[model samples]
Target: MKQMYIPVNTSLSFLLISLFATIMPAQAQSAASAKASAATSTSTSTPTSTAKPSLTVTATQVGSGQMATKLVANGSVAAWQEATIGSQSSGLRITELMVNVGDVVKRGQVLASFDSEAVRADLAQAKAALAEAEATALDSIANADRARGLQASGAISKQQIGQYLTAEQTAKARVAAAKASLDVQQLRLKYTQVVAPDAGVISARMATVGAVLGNGAELFRMIRQGRLEWRAEVTSADLSKLTAGMTATVMAPNGEQTQGKVRMVAPTVDVTNRAGLVYVDLILPKDKTAAAFKPGMFARGEFLLGSSQAITIPQQAVVVRDGFSYVFKLNPDQRVTQVKIQTGRRMQVNGSEQIEVLSGINAGTQIAASGVGFLNDGDLVKLVAPSAAVGAAPAAPAAKK
Candidate 1:
């Protein structure tokens, strides 16, 4: 630093200038140091955070209730008892077809007829032969009596009388044989017409007028006693729960419901499918106003397997994937956790279109109803209870007997 002298009058101004220069540089250096410290603090103390997907959710409560396992297996309706009307003898031409398909017939009612002209002729011949044999037997008896009288009078030898007696006995035996032949011929003539064995509707007609039939040729298909059956095949797992006399309802292909009781359970299971056939004898409505129920129609059914207490959730709460069902449950930490569930029967709730769960959910579990349709296994969702959906169909109340 150089020692410089200045005039006394300008000393204050020069001193002021010097002080400004010193203060300005010190202030600039202090500001730069403050900025460097701030930068270092920001780089070292920053926090890490994850962004979560936002979603709306609803909650529900699960409780104990009846669990019904409904099985929807396809099957057909068949006549509980049926007969294939057929003839017994061969070489007969049908002369009349009295009844037709859908006709209700009674037992022993004539269904069809065959030409009996030949049988009638044979029967007449047998009657004539029987009459001739009877006449011959009468003549032989007279000869035998004469032979006995001659033996008593000693006019003919004993050997000659014995020969006449033998001849009479042989003619008597021939008469008996002829009578039996005539009886058989009459019986055959009666077989020319076919009759119903029981009361039922005719399902089919195979024979017609001028058609020749062989032995045991089927003519008509009759449902014996107007009875029908619903044959439903169920899986092996469910077969054990079914029993005789259990109530069952069948929905036919034409949307007709038939009420019946379980009749028989097949002992042998189908090897391929491991299922058994369940026969349900239908109780047809006797009111003529009811529609006519026929056999061989495919049907669906529900069998009441008895009721038990179980946990159930709403069907809307369940999420199905790859043939399995799952539901999202809220943990204690307000996070979602996936849980696998086993569902039982599906039932209508209070006449509303919403479905009620049969089983697998617990009581008081928070469930996401609407928004979980797009969520993944471990997604974080913001819970928001949704208002009941609009225009929802009312559920059906419990069925009353």
Candidate 2:
């Protein structure tokens, strides 16, 4: 009905309005579809993730045992009691020697013999002089006896008797003097046999065959009683700890080990070296290692301080981080726990470096043997065979090209 008054412009306006109404339904449908698609995508889509990194490691178990705490030093093995056997008689030439170096001799055993020809000659001359004096004294004594017998009668004068008594006294004195000289020569002959002062091992021979030695000239040096000792030189501090009963081990140049006991601790320190000596007595029965070790051998010694139980591990298990020692211990969950430990003595057992753990770790614990330089606490690590790792961890699996 309104079209009776509608103009051409009004008709165009109506057409434009109808066209806009038709386009609105299509736009609403498109928006509803887009909203539904966005909801479905938000509810069912998968999330993106990143894989964590891990490390492979090699490890060793904690070692548990007793390690002897010891104080180490160097010293010399020597005779415990050295005796210098010397010539007691002067101007005597050695004729025969019955012993040499390294010979075991007994007390009062003959060691050498001196030439007794001079001694025998002196003794013979004294005996001849004594015989002459005895002959003169015999004639004088007979005259004295006749004089005494005549004194009871008138056989001789009193003055003659006195002269006979004086002659007899003089002749007896001469005989006494000759006899004394002969006895002195006989005593000299007895000293020709040189004998050992005590039972010992001969270490040195200064007297050669036919050696004319003076009185008190040394002929041999021996270890009295065949006893040996180790004179270990130690700092003043270490010397104080050694007592009379402490045990020690001495290793000779030939790698022979001998056992000894602390015999005495030196009271004074040496001025030059500022060190003191500890004398250790060696027990060398003929059946023991006594024959193997000799005097003047340079040996290293160890004084065992009383020992207690300790826990130890390979040196590689210990990691130095920020001036602290740490070890990675394997846990029940197949993970590792970083443990801070106190390190004690570092020793070698069969060419391997084994360290003592004082605290923060226990026996039977597993630790990373090596290659722990970059590991953090609570980090997951793969355990690899020790041999597989050249020096550290085994090479990782090659990635796909």
Candidate 3:
């Protein structure tokens, strides 16, 4: 009955409202279903976040131990005592040279020979003069005896007897002078040979064949007794720690190692450098010629000052980064915290190299013994028992049956 009076515009409006209501409900349901599907897919595809251990490692505790203490020094290898060999005779030519540089020689060993022809001729002349003087002395003695007999018989004047006695005295003086000249000539002859003053290894040679040398001219230089010493320069404060008879180890530039004993400590320190010299005599090896140590070689040495208590850890536990040393300390939660440390002397303990921890972590602190280089600060690590870690080495595949 109302439809009989309803306008066309009103009917269209009703129709649009009904259609909007139906479509809105359908779209809302579709959106809800899409949201539910998305939630289910996300719940199934997402992963749960769980932290994993970065590395599996072993732990060690810092312990107090005795480490050998040493004072290090830098210096040179030198001859214990150097002897300069020279020519004692003058105006002579070197006829022969028996030894060269690096030659081992003994005391009184003839190193060079000089021309002795002139000396021999002079010696012969001296001998002839001595013979002539002896003959003249005998004649003078006979005359003196005859004059004494004549004086007793009063057959000769007093002045004449005095003259005979004076003549006898003069002749005796000439004979003595001639004998002294012969002895002088013999000494000159002996000097013709240049001999070693002491047993040593020759270090330098200046004598050449046919080269005339003057008195006191150097011919060869040698290290007396073939001995070598390491002269280490140490700070004055540490010099007192070194004493004679202390053991020292010297390392040559060529990585050759030799043991030495402290010979002496310099009484005075250098004013400019405030350092003193510690002379250690090296115990040369059996084959001296083949020895790598030589004079004037720069070397480094360490003086053993005995053992002292120190906090130490295995060398592998320490890590060096950016020129600074560090160690990873383990926390109660099995996490590693990087700790910078000061390291000192390295020593062998129980056949393992241990490094002295001067400061940083204290004794009883646990640290990552190995695999530290691969770890970072505040990293979680898994720990295995000592026996388990040893057995963890990759086992070989079983042999074929």
Local distance difference test scores for all models: 0.77, 0.85, 0.89
Give the alpha carbon lDDT tens digit for every residue of 188-241 in model 1: 787887889889889899888999989899999988888888899899998888
Q: List TM-score per model, in order.
A: 0.62, 0.61, 0.78
lDDT of 3 by residue, 25-78 (tens): 999999999999999998888774345677778889999978999899999999
Ranking by TM-score: 3, 1, 2
**Which segments of candidate 3 are over 4 A away from where they belong?**
1-59, 287-290, 330-335, 349-351, 378-401
The RMSD (Cα, Å) of candidate 1 is 10.2
Residue-level lDDT of model 2, residues 54-80, one tens digit each, is: 567787888887777889999998888
Query: Candidate 2 has which clashing residue pairs, if any?
Result: none
Find the candidate with the highest lDDT and give its number: 3
lDDT of 3 at 130: 95
lDDT of 1 at 95: 86
* 1 versus 3: better TM-score goes to: 3
Q: Which pairs, if any, clash in model 3?
A: none
Worst 10 residues of 1 by lDDT: 392-401
